[model samples]
Target: MPTREEVIEALEAARKKLLTEDAKKEFKGWNRTIQYYFTDSDEYWHFKVEDGIPGELINTEAEDAEIQFKMKEDTLIGLIDGSINGMRAFTMGKIKVKASLKDISKLQKLV
Candidate 1:
């Protein structure tokens, strides 16, 4: 299990990744709100990616989230920090995602 701060830190790192030039190219024309629900901590955090730029993380439920992920705090931390692979986690049932194939594929770049 991970603390709230650790999960936040991991999210921040993902946001920072979107700041890179390559990331901008990769996520171009993408605008979506992604939410994460931590089962262990009962926490909700969401962020928007607009035209390749990532918005600040918000600690609330998303009004119209395009992609939603349900998992434990440790799983989220591991995914964001590269300790866990996203596809592997999903396949292993460590994470559950509610998203379209295209949307899910796009997010694979984040992990």
Candidate 2:
């Protein structure tokens, strides 16, 4: 169980990864509202990616998020920190995602 601060820190790292030059090219012209819902803490965090650049992490939900992730705090942190694999986690029932297959694949770019 990660604390809120830990989750935020992990998200900050993910945000930085999204801003890298390689990521920029890969995500070119992609824009979406991504939401994270931690089942353990009942906490929500979201961020908007515009033109491949991710903005600040907002500690609230996005009513119109294009992709939504639901998981435990540890799972969220693990995915962001590379300690856990997203696809494996999804297969193992550790994470739940609500998005189109395209968006789900795009998420592989972030986590």
Candidate 3:
């Protein structure tokens, strides 16, 4: 398992990647908040997107989160590093997402 800091770093990297592509328009244009909960770290990482732009990771409380994801640190790193596919992780029961199918698909495309 990675430390909490590693997880936060990975999430930050993902945010940068997401913001650079058309995927950002598709994913964050919804102007919603997404929260990631790591079971191993017992920490919540939040991304607040506004008009197709993603802001900094919110280490504090997530306000009005529209999507939530639960996973362990290893799986998150693998997914973020492109070593593991998000769909495969979900199907293999390594990751669990709580969100609408439309929103999930947008994020999956980004990853």
Candidate 4:
């Protein structure tokens, strides 16, 4: 298990990685606001993707978030680090996502 700071650092890293041009091109035209809540630490990270890439990352909740996800810190870290598959984790009940079908479908590739 990672400490809270370590998990946050990983998320920051992921946010940077997600903003790269190559990453953005992969999910072009999919714009959405996302909220991630780490259950273990009770921390929230809110961000948005516009025109297919990550926009800004902030340490507060977004009132208009189009998608919300919840999971353990370690699990989130694993997902970001590629140690855990998003689909597998979601199916296994390790993570929970709240969003409309369209948004969820588009977010699949982004994750």
Candidate 5:
């Protein structure tokens, strides 16, 4: 399993790839937050995306996020690297999300 810094780095790379392709526009006007709980380390990393930038890292006390995803760190790394499909993993119960179906659907496109 990768460390928290490694995971953040991977996510940043993914975000850059998405942005370079002009994919960030897909999230325009969308303000959502997601918390990733890495089971191995039992660490929680929060990601908040609003207006533009790749969102910010937040502490545990952050308010209710619009979306939250929980899964093993390795699985998350796979998802970011395109080895795992986010939607499929979620449907297969490997990834758990707490959010509206509508928002979840939109997130699928982004991932």
Candidate 6:
């Protein structure tokens, strides 16, 4: 299994790739926030995308987020690294997402 720092680095790389896409450019204008909680260590990290740039991490629970997703830390790294697909994992009961239907749909585009 990869370490927490490795996972975070991968996620950041993935986020940067997504931000450069034409479809994701609109996200740069929105105040988008995502919270990832590593189930194994029970550590929560929050990310915010603002003004076309990824913001710094914030240590706080995302009580009311536009979208929230849950998955094992290893699984999350795999998904972000293209080793696994989010839909496939979710369909196989390996991942869980909680949010409005619209947000879930939007997540498909984001992730």
In order of appearance, the predictions have TM-scores of 0.90, 0.91, 0.87, 0.80, 0.78, 0.78
Q: What number of backbone clashes does candidate 4 have, counting pairs of residues 3 or more apart or in separate chains?
A: 0
Tell me each candidate's RMSD, in Å, in order: 1.4, 1.3, 1.8, 2.2, 2.4, 2.4
Q: List where candidate 4 sits over 4 angstroms from the true fold.
A: none
Residue 99, model 3, lDDT = 83
**lDDT per model vs. reference:** 0.85, 0.87, 0.80, 0.81, 0.71, 0.69
lDDT (tens digit, per residue) of candidate 3 on 1-111: 787777888888877766776866566546878888888878888988888788889875586788888899888889878898888889988888878888877776665
Better of 1 and 5 by lDDT: 1
Local accuracy of candidate 5 as per-residue lDDT tens digits, 10-63: 656645543544556776676767666666777777767776445656546347
Name the better of 1 and 4 by lDDT. 1
Instruction: List, residue by residue over 1-111, the lDDT tens digit for candidate 2.
Output: 777789889878877888888899999899999898988888899999999999989998899999898999898788877799888999999999899999888767755
lDDT of 6: 0.69
The pairs that clash in candidate 1 are none
Single out the weakest 10-residue window by summed lDDT for candidate 4. Answer: 102-111
lDDT of 6 by residue, 30-87 (tens): 5667777667767666777665466776656676655565677888888877899888
Backbone collision count in every prediction?
0, 0, 0, 0, 0, 0
lDDT of 2: 0.87
Model 3 lowest lDDT segment of ten: 21-30
lDDT, model 4, position 62: 87
lDDT at residue 3 of model 2 (Cα atoms):
74
Clashing pairs for model 4 are none
Tell me the TM-score of model 1.
0.90
* Deviation (Å) of 111 in candidate 4: 4.6
